[model samples]
Target: MRVRRKPNPNRNHPLHCPYCASELLFPDEETEFAWSCQDCLRVFSVQFHGQDDPPVKPEPARSSHEALANSLKRKGHEL
Candidate 1:
């Protein structure tokens, strides 16, 4: 018996190339997780190391002491 599978819609979520955002990315059938960009001509592979999350940006430190001093100076109470 021949079984026909349904086509996936969300499979092409990230269809653009990283190097060139305007380029279309094509997956290599011979290699798993391998992708190529038509415009940039870049051949790369995708892999998930379980948790390959994006880097987090550090928050700027609050200057409470300087702010307090500035407020005091504005009220003519220089310290």
Candidate 2:
């Protein structure tokens, strides 16, 4: 039996906000498999397996890891 492996969630394609040169944030309010940039309001989808055209999505800054970690602790996630 062949066991399929799950794709790495942290692994993502290199992305940039064409407008502000800011690295586009991944995953907006719609889905976790997407990304977006607030500076230019441009959305993008990353190819996890190095295939398919990049998609787009709208995302905010607070969606980032550091910000999210802070939010989690604030909401009571033990450090």
Measured by lDDT, the strongest candidate is 1
Highest TM-score scorer: 1
Off by over 4 Å in 2: 1-15, 18-20, 24-26, 50-79
lDDT of 2 by residue, 29-60 (tens): 45545567877777765555555555875464
lDDT minimum window of 10 residues, candidate 2: 24-33
TM-score of 2: 0.35
* Tens digits of per-residue lDDT for model 1, 1-79: 9775554433343556777785587875545566788787877766554655469866766599988998898999979
Candidate 2 Cα lDDT to native: 0.65
Question: Candidate 1: where is the Cα deviation over 4 Å?
Answer: 1-13, 52-79
